[model samples]
Target chain A: MGELALRKPSGTLVALVAHTLRLQLKSALIWGGVLGAYAAAMVASYLSFGDPQQMEQIMAAYPPELLEAFGITDMSTIEGYLAGQVFNLAPLALAFFPILALSAAIAGSEERGTIDVLLGNPVPRWQLVVGSFVATAVSLLLIVFIMGAMMYGTAVLADTELGFVASVEGVLNLWPISLFFGGLALLCSAVFHRRALAIAVPGLVLLAMYLADTLGRVSEDLEVYRDFSVFYYYAPEGSAITDGIDWASFFGITGLAILFALFAVLVFRRRDIYT
Target chain B: MCAVIYTEDLTKTYGKARGIRDVNLTVEEGEVFGFLGPNGAGKTTAIRVLMNFLRPTSGRAEVFGRDTVKHSVEIRSAVGNLPGEFALEDKMTGERLLKFFARLRGVKDLGYARELAGRLGADLTRPMRRLSRGNKQKIGLIQAMFHRPPLLILDEPTGGLDPLVQEEFLRIIGEVRGEGRTVFFSSHVLSEVERVCDRVGIIREGELVDVEPTDNLVNKSFRHVRLVFEKPVDPGPFRALNGVENLCAEGPELRFTLYDDLDRMVKLAAQHRLVNMEYERPSLEEIFLTYYGASEEEDRDG
Candidate 1:
């Protein structure tokens, strides 16, 4: 009993965050490998176009509105083509990984009856919320880095001239949008006891936002609705890949993620954990 | 003795369903308090509120003189808990889980955890999903005890355990009591509670019906009485006796329930040629039913 004297609750937050991050490493690699392979293959496929100008002429036959909807403004450069093909829609799908993982952090753990044992320790409820978000945020970054490396490594292997900085900007830009939804899922998990609601709320928002952004680009009437969607802030087009990282959108999306994470902590701190 | 756990009119309601209702309880230090209840009797609910896993709807609870909600982290630091419906990550082995929990509690040594595992015959190397319910229960016990916290709040700690393991666990609990530590655990099994607990609190239908010392609770209940006569005898005297209910009579055998009329019964039996007599105490479940079942009928009548 003397050996069990209480210690200061200092390192629990760090320990929990690190443990969650370590647990997620395997899934992070798998997600990174799967998504990265697709990006890498897209990079390698650029060489098969034979002539960029001729291919651009062939793509020009498609409807202008349709091409704009898909973000195919230019197919001549590998950066422009990969931006439209990979970066444009990849975040929409990739965001679900964080949503799924983070939702399970609270609501899912409760559903599985594991929350009691975990919370049986002296962990602060706020730490559980914040630590999960931080870990998943870090894992999301790892996935983004892996995707960027694969794209760059494939470009080097194929002798393509995709700027390393552009590739880095393109993948790094996905972090904020993915983490934004992960934060939303975290909030939902804290507010609601059902894991399905936690996953579905953010999942539906992701799809609606994607449609709002894409449809807004094609129609003036729906364009106003795009401002309400989170996708409006995620501009991973020529701006992220060709121009540079959009600092405003980056901060806006990340700031919203932090806001949602704060709400998650507040709600989780007050709510009863049903097991 | 100081009260290690105290609740004042604690209540928790879930919509229309009753969780716990104005429940008051006190668990003294260095005593093993058994929270005895059947399923859906609010034992788990009360324990969860104490752990701060669920907040009380009304009133308050305290652990070691600190508010359960306001000082949950501190309370948890001083307490080891095993939830009734316990679970562990399916992919993690018991050893890894213990190590992870140890880190969270800032415990550097795994020596006690390893000793508990060995004593319980728990295979720490196997993943949780691969273990049987009893094995998982063993791991749960080890984790709750490894920290050696001053207070242990275990919900159904002996659930799914074999007789041998349960015996070992009871032995450990006895040792904990010897060290002047407080233990509060919930269980539906009475024999184990009778074996290890100093006091017993019986809850029925979301209310604390009775709280008494273990010996007193058993002593106050009815007993099964049997009398064998020398030859065929009339059953009129036994059947007409007060406090004798559920009487059965054969040619040379008579059986009945005796409630607080042992002296009268012995005198009545002396009138007959008593060849053999047998009197057995009722089980805890029967004692519980005698209390709640009668009260339920009284409520219905009102």
Candidate 2:
């Protein structure tokens, strides 16, 4: 057989991303379908709450601070209802998909003894890190879109006041925050050899930042600490569905995710991979 | 002939743990170089260093005349590597995995890959999780050979293979050598190395102890000498001979291991009326044992 010309690093990166995304397709769908169905169910359940005044009374029984902690402003509207029911909690769960996927990018593959075979094909180390991040990012978007479509479909079916644009904005806002955590997982994956540490560090940070953000909403003293959390810039007061998407915070959070991914590439490139 | 692999004082230390140290070696182009060692003897470590999986702590190596560290991707582009320990994705079938790798290498054809799969009996349709260890080894072998790279660096290539498969693998290695491709094969199994390797480098305790042509390594080593005399002869005279050990005598039969001074032993044996005489070259495994045993005894004496 005649020799095949060597592939450029860019070609390998593209192939890596394509293969990773293919591997993640089933997972993305499962995550998206489960979360999307739950969001849709929430949209369906909103219609059974009776009249607006009765819903107001039901929401009024709960403490305002408790409501604010969960990002629930007006439970009567579909936007406010989903803001608390799905969008707020979805990221806490959705973030894990990428966290697991991206963590598996370097450290997890190393532990599994799979990296050597893949890297044996003339792939640059940076391409591995970058390809994983990009693939997970795309998968995250698919999950968010699925969730958004389900929520929107249910809203239309239930004849609720939720606009298509509002549903898109709300779901779109979940992307960066979820990806930010996923990026942190990638960085951890790059720096550490064990996949458990890669998953745990980002996982612990996810819960802690969430707690800080939630408690900060309920307590004035802790509110200052929320500024340091990625969740702080996410959806403040369940506003994305009520209002439009927060473009500044959206880009800022996505930029932070990209930054974490970049740091992952740097660390992964220098370290020795152990299986 | 040009050198395909060159290393000068290559060292890799793992924070007080034992790794390869200052190992100087060379593998010429198209030569079948066997890296022989027991487990944890730095065979894998040295191969890993050459593959650029582990950065050298000191000194350097070059593959295909390119510095291993600086041009790792380029080196890898022309090298087919089978790591000693590896895992395939549980969810992917062998066919899918190869296609994915084929895409990565920019190889347009899967014809060679399919042929290899057929030859190795690699069940390309089954997910890797379901394959047996030996079966997985077959897939690993196929993936490394399918690309037809210039250099094949295989670590414990026949680790879990059955005898028939090992024979087939040796045949494949021979064919690779015939095609002017270099194979840097590592294994603790002496017989396989003896059969295929043109030159063998024996590593022990994280250092290369010897590197020489396979024929030279075997022929230049000790021999097993047996002598049967017409009448019962005094074993005392033969026992005191230089470079002779384990001299056992029963009636007229005398058997001993001869490391050197074969001429003196022959002369001493001629003093008795010899009925039969036999001198046999040791197998590679015996030669390897003798080599290791001598070194170990020296170490103990110190």
Which candidate number would show the highest lDDT if scored against the true structure?
1
> Tens digits of per-residue lDDT for model 2 on A1-275?
12324334448888989999999999999999999999999888888885777778988999999989888888777787888888778888999998999999998999999998888788999999999999999999999899888889888877788888888898888899999999999999999998999899989999999999999999999999898887878875456888777789999999999999999999988888787
Cα DockQ of the candidate 2 complex: 0.43
Each candidate's chain A: what TM-score?
0.96, 0.95
Kindly list the per-residue Cα lDDT of model 2 for residues B148-173, writing each as its tens digit.
99999999999998898899889999
Poorly placed runs, candidate 2 (over 4 Å): A1-10, B220-244, B247-289, B293-302
lDDT of 1 by residue, A1-275 (tens): 32344544679999999989988999999999989999999988888886999778978899999988877788999888988889888998899888999999999999999999999999999999999999999999999999999999999998889999999998998999999999999999999999999999999999989999899989999989889877777774454886678888999999999999999999999989898
CA lDDT, every prediction? 0.90, 0.88
In the range B1-302, model 1's lDDT, one tens digit per residue, is 78899999999989899899999999998999999887888999999999999999999999988889998998899899999997899989999999999998988999999998888899999999999999999999988999898999999999898899899999999999999999999988877888899999989888998899998876678889999989867888888888899999988989999887788889999898999999987776687778765566677998
Q: Using alpha carbons, what is the TM-score of model 2?
A: 0.91
Model 1 pairs in collision? none
